[model samples]
Target: MTAMTPTHGGPWTEEEFLALGEDNERTELFDGDLHMTASPTPWHQHVTTELLVALRAPVRARDLRIHAAVNLRLTPARIVIPDLTITTAIDFEQRIVPGSCARLVCEVTSPSNAATDLVLKMHYYAEAGIPWYLIVEHKAMTLRLLQLQRGTYVEHLTAEPGGVLRMSEPVTAEIRPESLLPEH
Candidate 1:
């Protein structure tokens, strides 16, 4: 995907983009600019599904909600559709509504979006005051967890095959590396 700057055909507003509504097309709003993403690959879906399952244990009984690849509105000028998100909102139907609540926002690193996820997305989510942000990568088959502090994300922990990711405070969970990789 090509990086862009503000132009006549640039800087899409929330209303104009939302008006496009939910469609097969996957788009993201970065600095109020629109960027299109290609369809997810099998590896992406594999990681997404595994994350949903792993997070379920932590959320199901605690009444927290975790979602995958869902549209999320961060501000009037910005919106982020994360690969995974965890929220404490009680009313699922009401909270999942576009432009609503989010506590933890996660993104799996992909070739096209890695830089956005690692740098830009982290900045956006943290600036929005999201409590937790996770970045899972396939590099050498490892998963890295990042937590927000003082409006920025810092490395919280890392886990690889045969190891489990551990969290502290607001939430606690473990992510086995094998669980994230696509099955042969």
Candidate 2:
């Protein structure tokens, strides 16, 4: 999706963006501008929810935290709501979590917002110093686990529908990609 025009043309600060209130569409501050979108489909939510359940045990075992669709403050003028967020126990209290606090950020790809999830978010997450990023592509039936290396995310592991996604870094989890498919 193209970038949404701001309600107020701004290089708006974080406070100004939040002050827009909840009446508007789902909005994000990207490079001090607004990025808005309609509600996501159930397919997207299904993929996201299953991944969250799969990752929870491993993350909690390591004493870290996991959350769904929360505002992540990458910078004063840059805020994003990731599909899922993982952080160290220390910064879990902050509502708009500092990007430095993030260990992993996950995005479930939507047809309407594919670029944001598959491309833009990777750049943003890496720039925010987030060490890991996960993308679950529903149409493609694949899961990718990316790790930041030399300031860019490298696809460290990937699994197709039949394969189980296994991770050893950051946390340990075995997730079957096909299990996230929407029920017909």
Candidate 3:
């Protein structure tokens, strides 16, 4: 299950896409098309790690599971790797988590994929009926919590650097945007 590149073209089947296997590149399948992005910067990885650490205890207390960089299957043709996901349970035998099981999905935006994370993924997550979406903007050093309302997302909270974001739904936790950044 290791491959350097996917050996197929557009309109790829799920089996073909999955066969691409584990690699350094960030690969996603959207409506039969393959989209690939560069590996995340070290800063991006650090932020995701810090957020995971901040969320683990509270999420675990609620008997939920939190995972980083896991495949989330929204539909037969659309599968994405979210930066972070909180779920009620994971089917260890399955290769992807169904969108229906997701409680919250988080994406930390890097310069290269800001638009996809902020706009495309947000819309897709909402359409799949995921309750919550969190976006962390790299350049702005801001965190935005969005709640799904009537098939669209509404901003519930926004925290800038030096500020704190506290939320009770999905999981009860306080996140400081600045704390996600690497120390100088």
Query: Could you tell me the TM-score of candidate 2?
Result: 0.92
Among these predicted structures, which one has the highest lDDT? 3
Segments in model 3 whose C-alpha atoms lie over 4 Å from true places: 1-10
lDDT (Cα, tens digit) per residue for candidate 3, span 131-164: 9999999999899999999999999999999899
Off by over 4 Å in 2: 1-6, 90-94
TM-score of decoy 1:
0.86
Which pairs clash inside model 1?
A: none
Better of 1 and 2 by TM-score: 2
lDDT of 3 at 10: 54
lDDT of 3: 0.89
Q: What RMSD value applies to candidate 1? A: 2.9
Q: Against the true structure, candidate 1 has what lDDT? A: 0.74
Distance from true location, Cα of 62 in model 3, Å: 1.4
Candidate 1 clashes: the total is 0
The TM-score leader among the candidates is 3
TM-score, per-candidate, Cα-based? 0.86, 0.92, 0.94
Q: How many clashing residue pairs, candidate 3? A: 0
Q: Model 1 — which ten-residue stretch has the worst lDDT?
A: 90-99
